[model samples]
Target: MKYVVTTVWKHPVKIDWQSMRQTMSKSKDNPHVAEIHWYEIDETTHGSVAIYHSRDAYEANLAFMQEHRSNSISERGIEMFPRSAW
Candidate 1:
């Protein structure tokens, strides 16, 4: 499974990209995670699209973000599609 997560930062001042990179690196320890692609959309927003082994993996990662980066998140969304359908 794979998911595309989009987030808009209302409190951009609270973000530290360096710290986020470290967190993502640490998250790789989860066997369900295949890869993550991070993106920067101007100064106030950034997000990631990740490949996970299951929905459980996706939810776990979302939970991790909520716990660690709650202050920086303004809006968020998740998308999943069958690979063959796409």
Candidate 2:
């Protein structure tokens, strides 16, 4: 079955929108990726939906994503802060 992942994160500080778009666009480099879309959840939050070929594909992507996160998001001081509205 296809695997779909939804993620939401917050940027306590200013965000580099161009870099965000570039990073997201790189998701297309993964052959297992079916579709991915990014959106603004609110003023400080962003969300994304990713569809993979299967659970296996999703799991594989998870590993790649972790490394990418460390190299890009983490390096940029981005934090996935807890949602206060919850």
Candidate 3:
């Protein structure tokens, strides 16, 4: 199944495009990730829609993120809503 995830967060400071780009680029390095659509909710708020090849892939992504970039994500963690329709 295609695993879908959406996450929204507010930066502790104003949005940093340089850091955001550098961070999001990590998705390209993970084979399990299909794609990611990022949105700028406002100057400090951001969101993303990430699609993974499988549930395991999504979980792996979470582990990797938690290990390498947990600070970038909200303390609440990523939000997921899985389905086969995609």
Q: Indicate which candidate wins on TM-score.
A: 2
For 1-86, candidate 1 gives per-residue lDDT tens digits of 55544433333244567876986788678676777666766454555666676777667666765565643333333222222210
Error of 2 at 8 (Å): 1.0
lDDT score at residue 60, model 3, on the 0-100 scale? 71
- Name the runs in model 3 displaced over 4 angstroms: 73-86
**TM-score for every candidate vs. truth?**
0.52, 0.76, 0.71
Per-prediction tally of clashes: 0, 0, 0
Candidate 1's displacement at residue 64, Å, is 5.0
Q: Give the per-residue lDDT of model 3 (tens digit) for 19-78.
A: 879878977878988988788888877777879999888877777755654544445343
Candidate 2 or 1, higher lDDT: 2
- Least accurate stretch of 10 residues (summed lDDT) in model 1? 77-86
Q: List the residue pairs that clash in candidate 1.
A: none
Clashing pairs in 3: none
RMSD in angstroms, candidate 2? 4.3
Candidate 2 whole-model C-alpha lDDT, 0 to 1: 0.72
Residue 30 accuracy (lDDT) in model 2: 84
TM-score of 3: 0.71
